[model samples]
Target: MWTTTPHIAALSVPTTDPSNTKCYTTKHLITGNRTSTQSEQQLPTYSNASQRSILLATARVIIFNPDNGLQATLNALIDQGSEATIVSEHVVQSLHLTRTSIAGVGQGLSLADPQYYRPKRVDLIIGVDLMAQIILPGIKVGAPNEPIAQNTQLGWILSGRTQPPREATHVVCHQAVLDTESLLKQFCEVESVPERRLNTAEDVWCETFFQQTHKRQPTGRYMVRLPLKTIFDPSMTLGKSHQIALNRYLQLERRLTKTPEAWQRYSDGIKEYFKLNQLAPATTSERQSTTVSDSQHHCSSCVLPHHAVYKEESLSTKLRIVFDASANTSNGRSLNDILCVGPTLQNDMSAVILNWRQYRYAFTADIQRMYRCIDVHPEDSEYQRI
Candidate 1:
């Protein structure tokens, strides 16, 4: 059953860290109270307050501890006042850490006097982004009809908040891939794209997200459908079958005569294409039937559904072909209805762009007529007849 309501889906992509990224994983042992620990497992530490914030940091936190790392209990609290993770000055100085800078996010570094003795207290303040990363037993981090923003609003209203110590300094930490609600909102809504360019927008968004979240280079053999042999092997326009001859194209010349201004350059382009490769005439009268049985057959014929749109100043022109591969000739199926479209595998464009940025220079090329260059297998030519 289907409903008319539009369904929304969100995928929270996990960030990948660098090989050298300083991070650690620690799990809490069930220990009662600060004094009641009888087992070897370390009990999960809590802030001075008993109740946890809506945005709670659980599991092992990957932190930057300057002095060979230290074991301490960090607090998790919900803060409606600020989106950044806030830490005390003592934690900053004790660790003597040089933090990474996140541009455009508010002033995150704030200083405050230590009010109470807490373990590993101030080196890093884990808030919303970091909290969302951790998944606890009872609560589903990502749930139905649950907006994190709404949760933060309701979280602050319902949960207890640990007040920052007096004279506390506020600092918003930044790394390339740390997940945040603001980042998601900004990525999806800020840019306005035309309806025709929605795919382009999606491509750009994926690329940005990949750059932000991933650090290490990808390693492993890619199981791409295109084989090394096929890619490296030059495409052939002519197979062994000398029986078939390349069809001569006159439509472009006919169209060019009507528009004399763009005729010379466009004509030259047409000639060059003819010399370089072979394209069979769609209306070739040699009348062939490669169509599967029980289908109406269509003869190749020429019609004025295509054009050579050109620029008057430069005489640059692009020839367009309008294909009616699905037309019902006495048979029911079309060329498109029978031929295989093959696989649809595309690399993450964003990841490609991200890796390109590491180099001092970058370049791109758009090869035209790529499909026509690939030679179909000799045996398969019959099925491919168009």
Candidate 2:
């Protein structure tokens, strides 16, 4: 028997006499006595799944009113893509929603594609209604020769948005929703060593190691070991250095117990130490190095020395370039010549390099590292140099 309420739907199967009315709600009559309920509050109230399906299947052509705010127009497109609604920037601003700037101008473009164009900052909103008017206005359906191409437009669809409707105003089960539910259930069922057990084992290991070496009193209850080197040499094992760090951390944790603020400082210090040495926690996907080889390199003509190098290296090693202090100037020379060898080296060097690439071609002629080496020239000095 299936029963539905405004807040819940209940399904039950009788185990006793099939025709008995009293056995319907009786807990003992059902196997496992399970009652399943579907709640109106839990289910979406969209007109129907079919309507949503139609909306997703139908390609929308948006016509922008340039006279209106450009940001509003872009926001409408983004909102529609994500939430299945079209909205304008003015509406977003009026609602006072937070807006983030687009990181780059051209978002969906291949490195080799010449026709790729990136837009300036585009505002995003959630919901189909927000973009419906922008992309599927009555005028767009009548115009056939417009520049819109389905391939390019489809890529503009944001992945983060809700699953598209199969049809407008109708509801249908989406494969994505089913897959996501299965994944969540699988995750919940997975079992691993509990954090408490791991922490206890680590504590025991440190305690035994410390007692064997240091004759001093082991007064602290908790212990932590900090690695000295970022990269652990295969031949090397935990030695006196590790023991000493463990003792220091235990002592610090003990001393800071009285002051909450000092405890935070101690915790921060430990994290910073690990981060600086690159000996932090390990993630599920271990860090790997990847490299690629190519015969040709392309340089951007818009900016001086804006080029990428083609190199052959192991797939495990990643290839990146970093500019040195010399290339960090306003000088007109291309900074592309300066390259750092590895990821760690690039990150460390980036802090020292001040000058950066600009959009204008004229700015590319400025001396590199102009900030560090060049000084403001006096009238007399300028005339003498000239």
Candidate 3:
């Protein structure tokens, strides 16, 4: 059953660090707390009294502590005016801390300060820092007195002034104070002489993988394996894609038929691929075994769908075959999805330009079929099967 009320859904995304990301998982149940936790704070020990009342903007949200895989539902204050986001100390204390290390932060930094202790009633305050990330673009206002609906990554939140409470006598005013000194210190840390750039765990693994797997062939061409993530193996999830590749090939043929010049270039390119030993026919046994049905029995070879790309501006080799590694298999994931994209090894463009400026003379040379120069490792070639 469904209701006509406007709503937004929080989409679940796969992540290596689920605790850190705002992703939803069904492993744990998260329910909102409707009962409010009320508290009163007086600046000068209740010297002033008020007779009017105002509505406070609060939304029920599930707060997750990725550090300990603990999640709790609480009513959060939606303060768009505040610059910093803060959670109650009690909320942090309530969540179990099994691990000492935070996801991406180094061990030395301490975020806790006794000076900024918030009252228990204010369970969570979603200030500008987090609001910028979670708040989605759209606002729905119904009638003149209804609560305004605001969209966020978590879901739709209902806020704004509703019907005033008849029993309300005191006007509750809340003030948010930001620590400028701490913020300035953080800003100075970012702006000061920079420390050595630290590579993430994934980046280190990618570098190690390249060093271990990449090799130079007798012909001076480099053969490298696709840097695939270990957690999500394509062989396990990849579905029957032979038909998909075949359909894409047929579509390419139809598209090429419209332009005979492009068709001839494509045909010549295929012939060149065979002539240069870049492409080869599968053996008889392989052809017999590698089929749509055979895929279910074992880890089948991936069939990469390819098409012609025409770059008219290029002085040499205007046409090329572009393999679509990102083409979706029967399963939602693609080859690109599982691959850990290795870091760029080349120098920056700015550095190259600076070097060029220092040199008395400079000339440019182009490598013939530069894109095809790198050879895929033999074991990894199945992933690039066309």
TM-score of each: 0.27, 0.13, 0.45
Which candidate model has the greater TM-score, 1 or 2?
1
Give the candidate order by descending lDDT. Answer: 3, 1, 2
Between candidates 2 and 3, the lDDT winner: 3
lDDT of 3 at 296: 54
Native-to-model Cα distance after best TM-score fit, residue 202 in candidate 3, in Å:
1.7
Give the alpha-carbon lDDT of every model.
Answer: 0.32, 0.26, 0.55
Alpha-carbon runs more than 4 Å astray in model 2: 1-235, 240-243, 264-386
Per TM-score, the best of the predicted structures is 3
lDDT per residue for candidate 3 within 1-386, as digits (tens), equals 21111111111122476333221111111111110666343121011125322233455678787877889976566677766656655667888633232232111111111211122255666778888788899899876655677787866766544454355489899999999999999999865644445678877888898799878889787777666663445354455455566677778888999999999999897667657666644322223434454445332345556678888898778897665666666765555555665555556565677789998999998666654566676545555556
Model 2 TM-score, 2 decimals: 0.13
- Regions of model 3 farther than 4 Å from truth: 1-197, 230-236, 283-300
| Model 1, residue 249: C-alpha shift (Å) | 9.7
Q: In order, what is each prediction's RMSD in angstroms?
A: 31.4, 36.1, 26.0
Residues 181-285 of candidate 1: C-alpha lDDT, one tens digit per residue: 988877876453313333454345444443453332243211111111122222211111111111112354566788776676555644553465332222222
Per-residue lDDT, model 3, residue 142, is 79
Best by the lDDT measure: 3
